[model samples]
Target: MSFAPYNDLRRHCAALGFGNQWTEAACALGNERFAACPHGDYPRWKAALDGLPAVPPAFRMREGMPCLGEDFQDQQGLADELMTFHPWRKGPLQLAGVTIDTEWRSDWKWSRIAPHIDLSAQRVLDIGCGNGYFGWRMLDAGAELVIGVDPTWVFVMQWLACRHFAGDLANFVLPQGIEDLPEQEVAFDSVFSMGVLYHRRDPAHHLARLHSLLKPGGTLVLETLVLPDDQADGVLVPEGRYARMRNVWAVPGCERLLRWVAEAGFSNAQIVDVNQTTVEEQRSTPWMTFESLDKTLDPQDSARTIEGHPAPRRAVLIARSA
Candidate 1:
């Protein structure tokens, strides 16, 4: 499905003189047909539209106009930058060294338990390892071998980073989902999955697939959004983004997730930690332009709230395989 906002962005760019060139470039990049923009006149072309009223000034135009720059280049740049300086970017994973305060690490309190897990010898698998930041951590933590799986073309960054840091790209595999992970028939001793379960339409199926990938006594680390006590079957935060079967399958409670893990043959499970406070403290960065912020924060927009609250909170879960 096309992200509506991005489609709107394409239209906005077209209105500002970035027409067929931008659209065709974006399509080609989206289809993975080209690496960097073949026509390299992106910055000059984008500069030509610098004063256009239709384009959002906040839009960073550089090297390969709306296409590679916006569509792929920026993301790749961010991934490359993140990989280069990751906390575990160098030596053995130091639990206390990770300082980036992204939403993923907000509730992360693994430092206290780091000493208990034998990361150095365990076979660790990181599912949905976007940019492989955490995967790098696993390696530093002493994991003998760290395998990261991500389906996006963004994996190119992970592949490059692995070649540089780990000395091999074989450790980082690309699989659309757990179901497609058979290429690595070697069962893992521990699996780390974060910020992924909630996005699945069939979370239970995903869990089952994960279970199948593990050897006996494997550990599965999970983190996801959960509904409040009063709300069962998940809550509808904003109109189009509800917790439904075809869409995201938000667990109503730890009990719901535990049930799925148990059905997948996991014998033990529990909420190792809950960060409702962290979620409450979170806030989106304000847009530089008032118009952009207004469109997102407008009171009339049903798509901006959770039962009327500004944003919904998420819950994290950690479970073990039977």
Candidate 2:
């Protein structure tokens, strides 16, 4: 565990809310806590903080929602909020036998899928990478180079951490989307996308773009919210004077999606994981309160359904480019 002198120290101090006056007092306390703790991850560090009744003023109150802060009300806003969380920093800090540093809520999803990845010698890409969490993990997992592309400034936070700790932002790129990627045809050996497909208005088009970026025989790791049955067509959130027009395209089924991936030039498409847990399963964090959000699928029904109800289940897929 080699630590960078001032740069890494400054970023960590800022993140922990020590600010510019991170003197011996703060450093001593932080170093003591860091040395005493067995797990060096975010959740564990947070748990340690929980035990300490006194916290720095910066972290004393909940700044905003976890990933999606108060500043984020829309998709773009959500992206910006994610940046503030600084997920990459969590990678250096591990906890509870798993790393919880990625932008996604479910760390288990990554654990289940990571084994199948041949990242040691591959060039990887993570699309819609919120704060480049998974991308950072991929780098840690031994990918020669990992590129995370997102439109949000939150990625800048991750970039800052990468530069400060890792000394370069080589593996991450903050492009608006695939269209904006520099001229590098079929460059990546593997591409990973989690929790992004369903948000797109045109899933097929997005798949095509992903296919275009991959080399022949490249692998694409995709995870998204899947509907229970095929009856649920995509939901359209109409544009308002203030609200951005967006569409929530739910996953119909694995077969249909695999076919689309094949059409996009990917073969060997397979679903790797399915999590049916409801929103209630989500832990109460400062970022967002899942319990407060109405989990009822029926518009008229007020009662919250815990089990055996219509809820978005996440599905992970691994596909190989033809």
Candidate 3:
């Protein structure tokens, strides 16, 4: 809710020796998008941010958990204030003293990814980076800086919660989507598009956007819902909804996924890790009260969603920009 975040980000970009014009444009976009934020809950979220204790900013990523600050005015009150940003989708973060068990055990996904990509000293971009959780993980993996974007305002609020404890850290989250970013070819050293491809109406266009964001031969870390090879011919275009998620436009088979990336000007597209989503990995917790994977799948069959579609299976593919 404050311009301080953008200011810190701009200064960090400058310190990293990024192009002045691009950094300025990015800061402007961040300010503009935040100014016109349409989320009705913005006021309450801002108040929650304002309500946080005036603790010294300190951040450390310990064992995949972003630990922020060491002291709090009131632990219970701090927890209550954080609860205002409910339905926390990504975390298990350590905020001051309060531990937030988020909906997704996102660290598990990161474990599957960290082994495949080399992010040491890389300038990275993360699309749909909920509350910048992976940004910390990426930072720990040795990325010099991580610019994360997510459309959801609550996630931005959550990032602020972490930022409240992180003084001028290189990890930043802008309240914008990947499409909203300025088109800068050869911009980042690595680009991550996770849990996002299936939601795009045109996955090819999405891939192109990702390609344009990275430098030639820059690493591309893409994680998305993928169907088994035998399940669909090429891509599965769900008739109604997939796993009660209406936005899922297409779930491609592993082979078609490679083809899409190949046609999008990416080279050496390879499936690095593929794992079926489990209820234990994603379920409602005290911090996220809504129903999750447990209720999304069929009670009768573990391998099928309640909608009778194949159960959720995700894949992490590593590619290089051509």
The sequence of per-residue lDDT tens digits that candidate 2 reaches over residues 7-48 is 434354345343333122333433443344343344443433
Local accuracy of candidate 3 as per-residue lDDT tens digits, 215-236: 8879899999988768534788
Using lDDT as the measure, which candidate wins?
3
- List ranges where model 1 is wrong by over 4 Å: 1-117, 162-175, 183-185, 230-239, 242-247, 277-312
Off by over 4 Å in 3: 1-4, 184-186
- Residue-level lDDT of model 1, residues 69-127, one tens digit each, is 11222433334343333222111211112123332332133442354466766667778
Of the two candidates 1 and 3, the one with more favorable TM-score, higher being better, is: 3
lDDT value, candidate 2, whole model:
0.51
Error of 3 at 125 (Å): 0.3
C-alpha lDDT (0 to 100) for residue 98 of candidate 3: 83
Ranking by TM-score: 3, 2, 1
Q: lDDT values of the candidates?
A: 0.46, 0.51, 0.87
The estimated TM-scores of all candidates read 0.55, 0.59, 0.96
Global local distance difference test of model 1: 0.46
Give candidate 3's total backbone clashes. Answer: 0
